[model samples]
Target: MERIAIIGCGGSGKSTIAKQLGLTLDLPVTHLDAVYYDENWKPLPQEEFAAQQEKLVAGERWLIEGNYASTLPIRLAAADTVIFLDLPAATCLWGILQRRWRYRGGQHHKDGVFDRITWNFVRYIIGYRKQMRPKVTALTAQHAPHARLLTFTSRRQANAFLSEVTTSA
Candidate 1:
């Protein structure tokens, strides 16, 4: 996998998997959150964000992680592989809580600011499968038909795939 795009809900471990894949495959990893959000958690202008993504994807190899579905087509067009973390809402909620605890009072490497587990964020995670999954599914099918698509319904499967890739590599 020279070029990979990892997409999922807010707490779905996209960044974690991307980092692991980057290390295993010796590919550069790009966290779209870092690209899109300023140090203060302010978002870049839409045009600027798109421009940045355009430049990143122009590179020969990269593992870009984010769920910016609107801009997914850009990365999808460039990637040779796509991974979708289709974990349950409970798992994702647990992940967010765990992350908040782990990174409390400090900024996460992939996040723009210190972790904050708000009710709105929780609600978004809870509703993601019903609301966003279909959209992502259609977009991937439409934009990256030739790309290798791998969907993991649980963290165990994701980790197994990572282990398999690492061993094979």
Candidate 2:
């Protein structure tokens, strides 16, 4: 599929799946974390973030992974497919924990990108659920009906979906 949008809760492996799909399809993958998080985990301005989203989705073929609710209409309008990683809350929590360990365990991301906050896990997992998941689910359902929406309930389902789907761009 061209112009795929992988939207999901934090630590749902949206970036990971998008990157893998991009590699397999020889397409470009854009991680929202890389785009939004600047040095020291500071957030970019709303205007800048919106601009970035616009420029990214302008591509004819690209895979973007994020749960930016404000950019949903823009992103989904241009996307031919939307892969929703509807992982269990437990799965996401576990993923976040594992990631924290990796980030705090001495793995540095691209220059000043991944700060690896040792304590934000609770917020991203528990707090973001009430704050973000509702918005994401609503937006996906709204813009993804015409678009191919692959909602994976678990990691196994995700892998299975990828196994059968040809990622040729």
Candidate 3:
């Protein structure tokens, strides 16, 4: 329960869940979005992103939320558990729509300055994940060989799973 990885498609509530988990556990949570996306919605160089993440993850306990496979293995190494949000494509889009709606209306989704860019960035959710699924599944198998992998196809299940995690899950 010391470290955890929340893996899922874009707009799949990975960051939100990780934030809540951090509050529940009172441990530091790393939102890879913040690390990967700089001001103006520009992406940090791979080397630079890796370096920044490498430094942040050196901590004894951390909860990393992201699906950037480039350096997922490194973070997964120290993660005691891996939570995968396995919602359907339509469901993912719905969540993204709701999230973007909130962002557009200045309700949620953190920074509002990047709300306009989110539309373009999110167009690849399905296609990208089609290619990313194999890698994600492989890593899930590789990292937590015997650890629990929770798949939620519905909001009910996802929320229930969170409610069930009483401790450092």
> Best-fitting candidate, measured by lDDT?
1
lDDT of 1 by residue, 1-169 (tens): 9999999988789878888899999999989888877667788998899899999999999999998888999999898999999999999988887877778744565543346667888898999999999999999999999999999999999999999999999
Give the per-residue lDDT of model 2 (tens digit) for 12-105: 7876687678878878888777787764677889889989989988888998887778877778878889887877678887876676665663
Better of 1 and 3 by lDDT: 1
For candidate 1, give the lDDT of residue 168: 100
Of 2 and 3, the candidate ranking higher by lDDT: 2
Which residue window of length 10 is worst by lDDT in model 1?
105-114
Regions of model 3 farther than 4 Å from truth? 105-123, 166-169
TM-score of each: 0.95, 0.83, 0.83
Q: List runs of model 1 lying over 4 Å from the truth.
A: 110-114
Per-candidate Cα RMSD to the true structure, in Å, reads 1.5, 2.9, 3.1
Q: Local error of candidate 1 at 147, Å?
A: 0.3
Ranking by TM-score: 1, 2, 3
What's the lDDT for residue 34 in model 3?
Answer: 71
Against the unseen true structure, what C-alpha lDDT does each candidate score?
0.88, 0.74, 0.72
Clashes of 3: 0
